[model samples]
Target chain A: MSEIVVTHVPHKRSIPFGQEAVGALSIIALGAIGYFLYPDDLAFLTRLIGIAFLVLSLDLVTGYCGVATLGHAAQFGVGAYAAGIACVRGITDPVALLAVGVFAGTIMGLISGALITRFRGLPQLVLSIAVGQLVAALANKLSWLTGGSDGLSGITPGKVFGIFNFDMYSRTAFLFSLGVLVIVFVLLQRFVRSPFGLMCRGIKDDDLRARMIGVSIYPRLVVMYGVAGAVAGIGGALTAISTGVVGLDSVSFERSAEVLVMLVLGGAGHLWGALAGTVIFMIFEHIVAAANPFHWMTLVGLLLILIVVFAPRGLIEPVLSLASRFKRKGEAA
Target chain B: MTNLLEARGVSCSFGGLHVTRDVNFKLTAGDRVALIGPNGAGKTTLVNLITGDIAPSEGQFFMGGDEITGLSIPDRVRRGLVRTFQTTRLFANLTVADNVALAIMQRKRITRRFFSSSTELPEVRAEWSEILSHLGLAKLAYRKVVELAYGQQRLIELAIGLALHPKVLLLDEPAAGVPHDEAPKILEAINRLPSDIAVLMIEHDMDLVFKFARRVLVLAAGRLIFEGSPDEVTADHEVRRAYLGSYADARRAT
Candidate 1:
C-alpha cells in the first residue's frame, strides 16, 4: 500500500492584509476608541454593542445566506425576553444568561427560518415581516409573562466570572460586551471563510445551481438562520443584562426596522460593514438627536438617502476598496 | 454489467402539455451517448427527469438497481448524477478556483466544516488543483468567473462536474453560447473525462455530436424516436425526417 500522508499548508501571508484581519482590527480598534471616547457614557457604548450583535446576525442570514428578512429583530427580542425571564426566575450567572439567550434565539431562528425559507423573494420578505409582527404581537398580548407594554424589570445579573460586579458606572458591562463582541467577531470571521460559509455564498448567488451541485438548500439555510439567531440572541441577552429591563421595544416592529436600516447603512454582506454600520448609525443618531432634538429624523433620513444613492454597497465599501488598493500599492513598492 | 442509470417509461407533463412522454434509456459504465432532437424535442426535459429536477409523472428511474425517481436534485447529485446547465451556471462573483473548490468540497462531504478555511484544506486543494490543471484552468484559478470568456466558463462547469466524481454526467448543450472557434475545446475536455463514468451529451452541433457519441438517442416532440450507432443515425428514415431533414435530403440528391 502507498504510504498515506496528510500535510497541512500553512496560511501564508507576506503582508498581514485581508478582510478578516481588517475586520478584527477594526472591531478591537473601535472597542478601544469607544472606551476612551465615551468613558462616562459607557452605557451608550454598551447599547451599541448589543445592537451590533443583531446587525451581525442579520448579515449572516441576509448577507451570507441570501436570506431576505425584515423581521430579524424577532430573534433578538426572543433572546432578550428569554434572558430577562431567566434572570427574574433567578438564573443570573451572566454567562449562563447569555447561553440561555443564544439557545432561545436559535430556536426562534429555526422556527422563523422554516417558515420563511419555504418561499422566495417577495413572499420570503413578506413571511419574515409577518413572523416579526406575529412575535411582537404575541409579546404584547402576553402581558402576564412579558410584562406587556410596561416591560419586564427587576432583572439583577450576577458578577462576571464571580469577580467583576456589574456596577452602576457601566464600565464592567461595557468591557464585558466588548469582550464578547471581539470573540464573536473572530468566530464569525472564521465562519464566513469556512466551507459552510462558501456554500451559503453559493446558495445566495444561485440557489438553482447550488441544488444542481448536490446541496440540500433548505436545511443549510435553516441552520444558518439558527446561527444568526444565536448571534442576535446574545445581543438581546446583553441588552437585558446591562439595562436591567426587557420591554415591548425589545420585540417591536420599529426595532426590527431600525436594525435593518443599520445593516443597510453599513453594508449587509461584510461582517465589518455590519459592525461599522451599527456604530456609525447609532453614534450619529445619538449625537444628531441630542443636537437637533426634533429634526434629527430628517438628518438621519438625508444621510441614509445620500449613502444609498452614492455608496449603494454601504459606507464601508469605499473604505474596504481603498484598503485593498493601498495594499496593492504597498506590494508594488 | 448492471446499468449505472436506467429510465423506464418516464413521462412528465406540465398542466395539460406533456413535456416528456414515455422516455426510456439505459447508461452502463463507460457509455458515450449523445441525445439529439429539435428545439422543443424534450431532450432537456428528459435529462431533468433523470436528474430529479422534475419528477416523472409515470415512470421510475434506477441507479445501480435502486429507484431514484423520488430523490431531490441534490440527492441525485450525491448519488453521482451531475449535470451542467445549457446556459453555463457558475458562481460568477467567485474565483474560478472557488467555483471548482465548492464542488470538490461537496463531493468530499466537507462543505459543512465551519472552523477551517475551505481553500486551505489539503485534500480539497489537491482535488481542485488536479481538476483545474486537468482542464487547463490552473492559470485562471484566481480570476473571477465573471471575467472569463464564455468558453472558459463552460470549461469551468465541466471542471465542477468532474470535481463531483459523477457516475452519470449530463451535458445540457455544453457548447451553447460558446464562440464557434472555442467550442471544440469544450468537446475536447468532455472527451478527456474519466472512462469509467457514463456521459450523455445534448448538442445542436452535428459535427460535435458525431465526434463525441458512440451511441445516439434522438428525441422528437417528447418521444425517443431513434437509438443507434453514429453511422446508422444518419441512415435512419425517421431520424432523417425529424432531425437531419435537409442534410439527409441533400445527401440523397447527391
Candidate 2:
C-alpha cells in the first residue's frame, strides 16, 4: 500500500507532454515557413495575426475569466494612436512602439476594470459601452494629436533590427507580428493553466464562494484586465506599424462589436478558438468584399445570427466533436 | 478558554425593520453550537453578519481575540473565519475536484506570472487529490457539480469549505434541503472535523440538532432568548413557547 501510494503521488507527471512538444514545434515550423515563403503578403498577414492576438486577449478576460466588456476597442485605439504619433515624431523603433502601446492599453484597462468591478450583468455591460464611447469621443475631439478626421498617416518604417528595413515587401513585418503572437499565445496558455487562472475561473463560477475560499476577486480582476489590455494594445501597435496609419475607426463601436463576434464565433474558452475565429471572419470578409462589397455586412450578420442560434459553442466545438468521433471509429475498426 | 469567535452588541436593520437586535454570542475552540429558530428569525442574517457579507448597524466581532469587525468576507476568511451559505454554492460547471482545488488555491498568494503552468505544480495536484479522497469524493471527482444529486452537491460544498482549512466553520442550515437519509453522513462528517476547528451551525431539525450540537442557542425575533445545553433548551418552557410552538407536540413525543 505504501509503495502504491508513493508511486501514485506523481500521477500528474503524465500530462501529455509529448503531444504539447510536437504542437509547439509544429507552430514554430509553420511560422518560419510562412515567414519565408510569403514575405510580400506579410504585411496583411501581420495585421491578421495581430488582430487574432487581440481577440485572444479579449476571450481570455471575457470568455475564460468571465468578465464581459464592450469597451475593449478603446484600449486598441489608444495603442494604435500612441504608436502612430510616435512614428510621426520620427521614433520608429518597434520596441518603443510596443512599449508605448502596452503602457497606454494597461492604463485604460485598469480604469475600465475598476469602474466595472462594482457592477454585474447589464450594469457592467452598459458601463463598458460607455467607456468605449468615451474613448471614441476623446479620439475624435483630439484632432491635433490624433490627426482628427484626417487620420494620422505620415509614417516612415524603420529597421526592425538595424539590418532588416520594413520595406513595402512586408517580410520583416510578418515575421515580427508572428513572433509576438507566438509569445503571447505561449504566455497566455501558461497563465490560464496557472493558479491565478484557476482563481479567475473560480471567481467566475461563484464570487461569494471564491471569497469564502479566501480569493480576493477585485484586485486580481484588475490585474487580469490590465494584462488583457496590454495584449490588445500590442495588436493595435502592430496594425499602426504595418499599415502606417491610425484613425478614429480604431476606437469605434463597430471594431469592438466585430472582435466580440469573432470571439463568439471561434469559441471563448480556448485560445486557439480566438485565432480560428478571427482568421475565418477575416477570410469571409475578404471573399465577400471581393465578390460584392455592398451586401457583405448583411451576409456576415446573418452568419453570426445563425452561428449563435444553432451553434452557440462556436465552430471549434463541432470540429472537436467530429475529430473525437473519427478517433472512436478508428478504435472500433 | 478564550472564544475562537465572539460577537457583541451586533445589531442590523433593513430600512425600517430590525433583523438582528443587539445579539451576543461566543464560540470557543472545540465548541459545537447550534443556532435554532423558526424561519424569519434572522438566523441566516446573523450568519451573514458574522461572515462579513453585511455590515452590522453596531457591533464588534473578534476571532482569536483579534478584532475583525470591519473586515471584508475574503479578509475574514484569510484570518481563519469562514462560513457556508444557506443555499449550497457549488460551481455547477466545474468538476468536483476542480471546485475543491479552487478552494485550496484561493488561500495562496497567487502571482501574475503569465509563463508559469498550474498543472505542473505537484503540491496543488496532491492537495487536490487528498481533499477529494478525504471527503470520499474521489470517485466523483471528475463529475460536474450540476450532475450530482442535491445531497452530493451539499457534500461538495462542504468539501470546498473543508479545503479552506478554516479554524471556524459556520454552516447555515447545512441539512436544510438535504434528504433525511443523507443528513447523517453530513452530520457525521461535521462531527469528525478537528476539535480545534469550532463549528457554529444553524439548523431547524430538532433531532439532528440535538444529536450533533453540544450546546444550543435559541433566537426569537432576532434576539438571543436562550443559550444552554441541548437538554436544557428542550426543557426550557419559555424558549419552547417563543420559537417551538409547532414543535411542542413533537418535542414532547421525543
Candidate 3:
C-alpha cells in the first residue's frame, strides 16, 4: 500500500508532461508529412489546420465543459470575417490578422456563451444552433461588409514578419498555419491541465456538485467560452489568411455540424484527440469526396456510424489504452 | 456567542405540499447534532434549504449573524457552509486526489490559474497529501472515484466537505449505502473531524447517530418535534412515537 501510494503521488506531476511531449512531437511529425507528401495541396492542409482549431475550441466547451453546442462555427466565422475585414481595411499583417481573429472569436464566444450557458441539455443545444443561424443571417444581410453569399474576398495579407511571403502556391500559408497549430497546441496542453481546466472537467461531470464546491457555474462557463472562442478565432483567421477569402460557408450550420463530427470522430475531451479527429475526418473526407463527389456525404455518414458504434469515446480511447498497456508491460520487463 | 448556523422559521413548499414548515435550528461551534426522522419527514429538505439547494419559501438563514436568504448555492458554500449528499456525488471520472484537490483549489482561489499545472502546485499537493493521509486514503488517492468501493466514495465525499473548510457541515446520511462492516470506518473519520467545526448529520442509522451525536433533533411531518441529548431523545414520548417500532424499540431491547 505504501509503495503504491509513493509511486502514484509523484507520477501525477510528471505523467502529463510526457504525454504533452509526445503530442507536440506527433503534431510536428504530422505537419512535416503533410508538407512533404502533398506539397502541391498545401492549401488543403492549411484549411485542415484552421478546422482543427475550431474543433479544439469546441472540445473545450462541448467536450471538457460538457456544454452542447451545434453553433461553434459562429465563432470560427466571426473570426474569419474579422480577419478578412481587417485585411480589406489595410490591417493585412498575417500575425496582426490572427490577433484580430482571436479578439473577435473571444467576444463572440462570450456573447453566445452567456446566452447559451443559461440553460442546460436540449435547450442549450437549440440555443447554440439558433445563435449560429442568427450570425449567418446577419452576415448574409450585411452584404456591403460581408459580401453576403458571395463571401468577403480580395484579401491579400502581407508577408509574415516581413518575410516568408504567402505565395500563390500557399507554401508560406501552410507553414504559418502549422506553426500556429503547434504554438496553440503547446499552450492549450498547458491550459487544459491547469486548475481552470480541471474545474471545467469537474463541472462537466457534475455541475451541481461543482456549484456545491463553490464554483459560479455561469461566470466560469462564460469565461471558458471566451477562451474557446479565441482559439476558434485563430482557426477562422488562418482560413481567411491562407485562402484569401471569407465565405458564408465559414459560419454555416453545416460547417459547425461537420467540425463537431470531426471532434467526436477523433474523441472529444483529450486535446490530442481533437487534433487526431480533425486530421482523420478531414483527410477521409478529402479522399472520399475526390473519389465520389456525388455520394461523399453518404460515405462520411457511414464512417460516422462505424466510429460511433465501435469507438464511442472516439478513436483516441483505444489507441491510448493500448499505449498505456504497452508502457506497463515495458515497465514490468 | 453567535451561532455558526441558524435557521429562523424556515419553510419550504412545492406548490401546496409543505416539505419544511416553520423549521428552526441552531448549531454553534463543535456541535454534534443528529437530525433523524422517518422517511420523507423533511430532513433532506431542511438540509437542502440550508445548503441553498432549494430556497426556503419563508424565513432566513444566518451564518455568523449574517442573513443569507438570497445567496446562491456557491455563495453559501464560499461562506464555509458545506454539505455531503445522502448518495455520494463525486467527480466519478476524476482521481480521488483530483476530487479533493478541486475543493482545495476552490478554497485557495487558484482555480482560475490557467497557465500553471494543477498537479505540480506544491501548496495544493501538500494540502491534499496531508488530507488524504489523515483520512487513511493515501493508497487510493490515484484511483478514479468510480473505481473505489461505495464506502470509500463516501469518505471521499467527507474529504471534499472538509476541503471546503466549513464552519457548519451538513451531512445527509454519510453511511447510507456502505457495507455493515465498513460503516464504522466512516464513523471513525467523521468523529475525527476538526473539533471547532460544527457538524449536523441526518442519518437513519440509530447506532451511528447514538455513537456520533451528543444531541439529537427529531422531526415529523416537516416540523421539529424534539431536540435534546441522545438519552432524553430515546425517552421522549414524541421521539419514541416518531421512530415507532424501530429506534425506540431497539433502545428498549438494548
Candidate 4:
C-alpha cells in the first residue's frame, strides 16, 4: 500500500520514451546502414533522404493538421533552387545553403498558406496544385538563372564547418542529411505532443468546435505551413548539395503528387512514417523500374490502392494501434 | 458592468425573411436565465448572434458594457463568452479530460507551449479533477468523447464550457439526448457553477428550465414574447399559447 503509484490524470507519460527512443534508434540505424551496406549507392540514398523530408513536411500539414494539399513540392523546389542559386552566387558554405533553403521554403509556404487555408476541401487542393505548377513553370522559363531544363549545375557546397568536405563517395552528404533529419524529427515529435499541436489536432477534428473554443485556426495553420516548409527546405537544399544540381523536377506537379502517395504509403501523421514510406517507395521503384520502367508504375498504383483500402489511417498507424491494444490487454491481465 | 452580457435591438434576417428581430436582452452576474421557444422561433439564431457565430443585421451585443458588435467566435470566447453546442461537439478522438483541459489551456494562454505536458501539470490536473467531479464525470475522464454515452457527452460539453472559466456561459440544450433520470445531474451541475459566472441556458425541457431558471425569457416567431420570474412565466397567457401552452399548466401544477 505504501508503494502505491498514482499516474497523471491525463495518462500522458512524462517522458515520451517510446517515440524518442524510436526516433533516435531509427536515425542511428539509418546512419549505420548508409555507412556500411549502402556505400556504393550513397548518392541515390542521399537523394531519397531529401524526398523523405518533403514527405514529412507534407505529413505535418496534410496528416497532422488536415490541410488538403498536393503542391508541397513547390516549397521543396524553391528550397532546392535557392540552395543552387546560393552556390552559383558563391554562398558556398553548406550551413548557409541550408539557411537559404529554409528561407525560400518559409516564404512560399506563407504565401500559399494564406491563400489555400482561406478555402476548404476541393478549393484548397486545386490552389495547392496550381501553386506547384506555377513554381515549376517559372523554374523552366527562367533559363538564365535556372539554366532551363538542364537544371542549375556547378553547385559545390563547401565543407561541414569547413572540416569534412563533400567527397565523391558521398559520406559527408549522408551524415549531414541524417543529422538534419534527426533534429527535425525530435522537434516535430515535441510539436505533435504540445498544446499547439493538440489544438491543431482539435482544428482538424472539428474546425467549428475549435473556433468555438477560441482557436484562430487560420494563423495556427499558416505557422504550421511555414515550419513544414523550413523542414522541407532542408531536404531540398540537401538534395542540391549532394547531387550538385537543381532541376525543375524538384517542384514538378509529379513530385508533389508522388510525395503525397509516399506519405499515404508509409503513414502520414507520424514523422517516422515519412522516412519509412520514402525508403520503401524509392527502393521499390529503383528495383521494379530497373526491370520494367512502364509497368513499374502499375505495381505502385496497385500498392497505393491496397494501402488506401486496407490501412486507411496510413501504414504505420495500424501497427501502432495493434501494439497499444496488446499493451492494454496485458495490463488487464 | 452590472450586466455581464447584453443584446440591444439585435435582429438578424436571411434573404427576404427575418429570423430574429429587435430583441433587447441582458444578463447580470450569477443570473440563471433560460431562453425558451418552440421550433423555428429563432432560438438558435439569437444565440448565434450573441456568441458571434453570425452577425446581427441590426443592433449590437455587449460583454461587460463594451460593444462586441463584430468580433469573431474565438475573440468573443477570449472575453469569457463561452458556449456549449446543441449537438455536443466535443473533440471525438480525444479523451474527455483532453477536451476540458484544452479549454483550460486556452484560458491559461499556454496553448502555444510546445514541450510542456498539459496533463502532467499539477494545476491542470487539479482543475480537471474539480470540474469533472462537479459534473460527475471524474471517472469518465479517460474515455473518448465518441465512446461516451450521449448523456455523458452532454455533461462533458458542459464541463468543457465551465473549464473556459466563462463570465457568461450559453448552454444550448444541456440535456438534449440525456436520459430522464440523468437530467437532474445536469441541472445540479448548473446549480453548482461559481456564483460570479452568469449562465444563459437554452433548453426545451420545461421542467428542467422551470427548476433551474430564476428568470425565463420566451421567444416566439422570432420575437421576445415574455420575460419574468418562473411563476410569472408559468402564469403568462401569451407564453402559454405561443411557446409553453399545455406545459405551463403542468409546470404550474408542480
Candidate 5:
C-alpha cells in the first residue's frame, strides 16, 4: 500500500475589490475622523501629508521612471513660491493658486527635463544637482519676488469654497491637503499601471533596446519628467496653503535628500511605500527630537545607514513578504 | 525574383581604416545565405550596414524596393527588417515571456496608460505562447533570463527576433557560443522558419554552413571573394585558397 501526497504551488491572485477598495475606504474614513477630532494638530499633519505626496512624485521619476534626479525639489520650490506669492498679493482663490502652481511646475519640469535628458550617467546626476542649486539661488537672489532669506511670510490662508476659513484651528486645511493627496496618489497609481509606465520601465532596463523597438526615449522622458514635476509642484502648493508660509527650505538640498531618504525607507517602486516611509520617518524624527534634542540627527543617520546596509528593499517590503507568508501558512494549516 | 535587400557599392570606414570596401550583395526573399569570412573581414560591420545600425560612408542600401540608407534601427524593424546581436542582448531581470511580449506589444499602436498592470491581450498572449512553444521555451517562460543556459539565451534572443515579424532576419553568429550538440537544433529552427522570411546569417561553423545554407557569400579582407551555391563556393579555387587553407589535408581525410 502507498500513501498519496499533494503539493500546492502558490499562484498570484487577480485584483480583488475587497483588498484595494476596502483599503482606500478605510484610509479616507480615518482621515475624515482625524480631521474632525484633532483640529488643533491638523495643520501640521496636513503639511506632513503634503510632503509625503511630494516624495511620491520623486519616487515616480527616480524609482519607477529610472531617471535619477536631485532637482525635483526645484519644481516643488517653484510651486510653493507661486502659491505663496499669489497669497501675498491677495490672490486668495484656491483654483487660481493651484493653476499657477501646476503651470509653473510643468514649465520648469519641461525645461529641466530637456536639459538633463541630453546627458546620461554621472553627468545627468550632476546636472540635476546644479539645477536644484540654480533654482534655490534664484529664489534667494530675487528678494523682490521670493522675499529673500527672510522667507515669504504673512501668507493669509483664505476660506475654502467660501465656507470654512483656513486658520490656526486647522479643520479646513487638513481636509484640503488630504483631498489633494488622495487625488494625486490615485492619478499616479493609474499612470504607473498604464502602457506608458511599461514603456518607461523598458527604457530604464535598456534604452537602446527600447529605441530599437520604436519607443523614443527622449520624448517619453521629457513627458514623464514634466508630469512628475507638476505633481511635486502641486504638493508644494499644498504645503503653502497648509502652513501659510513659504521658506527657502522648500528647494534646499537637505530637503531633497530627506525626501530621497523617505523614498528609500518606504520602498521606491511602490507608492504606498513612499507614503509609509514619510510618515514613519516624520514620526520617528518627532519622537527622537522630543526625547534627545542634540542626538536626533545622529540617531536618524545611524538608522538610515543600518536600513541601507541590511534591508536595502526598505522597511515595507519585509512586512509585505511576511504578511504573504502568514497568509500562505494559514491556508496550508 | 528581385532581391528583397540590395547593398550596392556599400563601403564603410572607421577612422581611416576601410572595413567594408565597395562590397555589393543582394538577398532575394526566401534565400538562406551564409556570410563567411576571416576574423576581421567586416562581416558584422556589413550586417550592421544592412540592418541600419550605422550609415554607409559611401554607397546605398535598399530593402524591398525602398532606400533605407539612413533609417533608424527601430524604423528599419518597423519596415520588416531586424537583426540579432553577436552577443546575446536579453533583459537579464525580465522573464523570457516578458521579453518576447514587449517586442510583440511595441509593434502595436496601443496608447500607454499609466498605473495599470500590463493587460496581455488575447492576440498578444497567443503570439507570445506560439513563439515560445516554437522555440521549446514554453516551460521556461517565467524564468529570469540570467538563469538560462547560454544556448537557451541565444534561442530566447532568436525568439525575440521572430516576435518582431520581420520580413528579413539577420543572425550575427547565432551559433557562436552554443555547444556542439546544440548547434543542430539552432540550425534546424532556422531551416524550419517560414519561406517568406529570408535569413542572412554570419557563421564560423563550417558544418552548419554546409548543412543549412543554400547559398554562401565569402568575404576575405573586407571584399566579396565568392558568392554562389555551397558546391560552387567549395569548388572556387580562390575561395578554397582564401578560406580552407588546409583543403588538401581535409580532402585526404575524405
Candidate 6:
C-alpha cells in the first residue's frame, strides 16, 4: 500500500511532497508551537483541535456530499458519552476510550445517516435537528447513567502507553489529540482523492447524472454519513479523554450549529478549512468572551455575516486560487 | 429472438393526466432505432419508464428477456441499458475528462478504492482516452463542464453515456442544441459505437434521425403512430400529418 505516486485531483492528495504533506506538517507544527507558546492555554487549544475534528467530519457529508445538516454534534456527543461511560465502567485506557468513541460514532452515523440521507431541503434540516434534540432529551431523561444535567464526572483516563499522564496543563492530551488529528486528516486526504470520494463529489454535483451512470445514491450517501459520524465520534472521545468530563452540552443543538459555523468560516469541503475555521472561531471566542462575555456572541454573529457576504465560498477558496495563480505565473516565467 | 430491451404496454400518468399511454417497443441486438414526436409527445416519459426513472402504472420492462420492471435507474444502467438526458446532465464543476471518468469508474464498479484516484487507474485512462477522442472532446477534457459552450457540453454528455458501454443506448436529443457544423462529431461518435450494441436515438432533427437511424418509430400524444424504415416513415402520409409537416415544409421550401 505504500508507494510513491502523484495525485491529479486537488481536493485529495496523500503524497508527502505536496500541499497534503504541507498541511499535515502545519497541523503538527501548530500543536507543538501552541503547546510551547500557550502552555497555560493548552487545554483550550486541545479542545479546539477536538472541535476541528468534528468540523472535519461535517465537511465530509455537508461539503463533499452536499448533505445539509445542523445536528452533527449528535455524533460527537454520542462518542463522548460512549467514551465517558467506558471510563466510568472501569475501562480507563486512553486508546480504549478513543476506539469505543469511534465505534459509537460510526454506528450512530450509519443509523442517522440512513435517516438523514432519505430527505432533502426542509425535512432534512428538521430530521437533523430532531435527531440531535432527541439524543439530548434522551441524555437528559436518562440521568441515572449519564449524570444528566450535572454532566458525567470522574472520567479519569490512564496515560499514553502508560508513560504520559493527562496533567493539569493537558500537554499529553494536546499531543495525543494532535496525533489523532494528523492521522485522521491524512486518512481523509487519501479518501477524498479515492474513486469512492470522487463518486461522492459526483453525487453531490449531480445525483441524477450519478444515477444515470449506475451509482446507487442512497447506500453510498448512507456510508458517507456513517463515516462522518465515525470522525465526529473521534472528536468526542478526544474531548472526553482530554477533559475527563462529558457534559449534556456536548450533544446539544448549539454544539452542532457551532461546528457548522466553524466549517463555513474556514471552508467546508477542504479538510484544512476545518482547522482554519476551528482555530479562528475558538480564539475569537476566547478573546471576545474574556473581554465581554455578552458581546462575544454578537461579534461571532457579525463575523459570520461578514464571511458570508465577502467570502461566500469560505476563506480558503480565495487564498488557494491566488496562490495557484502566482504559482502558474512563476512556472511561466 | 429475445429483444435486447423491451417496453411492453407501458403507461404512466401525472396526477390525472396520462403522460405515456401503453407504449409497446422493442430493440434487437445492434438495431439503430429512433423515436420522434411533437413536443409533449411522451417520448421522454417512455424513455424514463424504460430506464426506470419512474415506474409505469401499467405494463413491464425486459432486458435481454429478463424482468427488470422494478429495477432502479442505476440498476438498469448496470444491466447495460444506458441513456443521456434531453437536456444536458453533467457534473458542471468537474472537468470533462473527470465527468467521463466518473461514468467509466461507475461502469467498472471500481469507484470504491480509498487510496488511489480513479484517473490513475489504467482501465479508467484507457476508457477516458477512447471516449474523449471518439467525441473529439480531447481538447476540452481539462476544462470544467460549466465553462464549455452548450454544444461542447452536449458532446460531453454523449461521451459520458458512451463511457458506460451500453448494451442498448437511448440517446434523447443528442444533437438538440448542437449547430449543424458541429453535429457530425456526435454522429461520428454514434457511428463509431460497436456494431453489436443497439442504439435508439430520440431526435426532432429528421436529417440526423434519417442519417443515423435505419429504423424509426414515431410517437404523437403518447401513442406509437408509426414504426418502419427511415424512407418508409418519411413517405408515410400519417407521419406527414402529425409530425413531418414542418420538416417536409422546410425541405420543400429549400
Model 1: runs farther than 4 Å from truth?
A1-22, A325-333, B249-254
- Model 2 steric clash pairs: none
Best by DockQ: 3
Task: Give every collision pair in model 3.
Answer: none
- Residue-level lDDT of model 1, residues A8-115, one tens digit each, is 222335443375676667777877887898798899999999999999999999888888888999999999999999999999899999999999999999999999
State in Å the error of residue A324, model 2: 7.5
Encode model 4's per-residue lDDT on A225-314: one tens digit a residue.
888898889899999999999987898989999999899888877777777889889988888888988899898888788888998877
Question: Over the stretch B156-191, how does candidate 6's per-residue lDDT look in tens digits?
Answer: 888888888899999999999888899987887788
Q: Candidate 6: interface RMSD in Å?
A: 6.9
Each model's lDDT comes to 0.89, 0.81, 0.91, 0.87, 0.80, 0.88
How many angstroms is residue A182 displaced in model 4 relative to the true structure, after the best TM-score fit? 0.9
Which candidate model has the greater TM-score, 2 or 3? Answer: 3
TM-score of each: 0.94, 0.91, 0.97, 0.95, 0.87, 0.95
User: What's the residue-level lDDT of A166 in candidate 4?
Assistant: 97
| Interface DockQ of each model | 0.52, 0.46, 0.59, 0.50, 0.33, 0.51
TM-score of chain A in every predicted structure: 0.93, 0.89, 0.95, 0.94, 0.89, 0.94
Which number leads on lDDT? 3
Regions of candidate 2 where Cα sits further than 4 Å from its true position: A1-42, A319-333, B111-114, B245-254
**B27-73 in candidate 1: lDDT tens per residue?**
99999999999999998888888888777889999999999989889
- Best to worst by lDDT, what's the order? 3, 1, 6, 4, 2, 5
Which window of ten consecutive residues has the lowest lDDT sum in model 5 chain B? B111-120
TM-score of chain B of each: 0.96, 0.94, 0.97, 0.96, 0.94, 0.95
Tens-place lDDT per residue, model 2, A173-244, is: 777887777677776777776777867777888888888877778898888888888888898898898888
Backbone atom clashes (below 3 Å) for every candidate: 0, 0, 0, 1, 15, 0
Interface RMSD values, listed in order for every candidate: 5.1, 3.4, 3.3, 4.5, 6.5, 6.9
Task: Return the TM-score for candidate 6, rounded to 2 decimals.
Answer: 0.95
Candidate 6 reference-contact recovery: 0.72
lDDT of 6 by residue, A105-173 (tens): 999999899999999889999999999999999989899889999999999999888999889988899
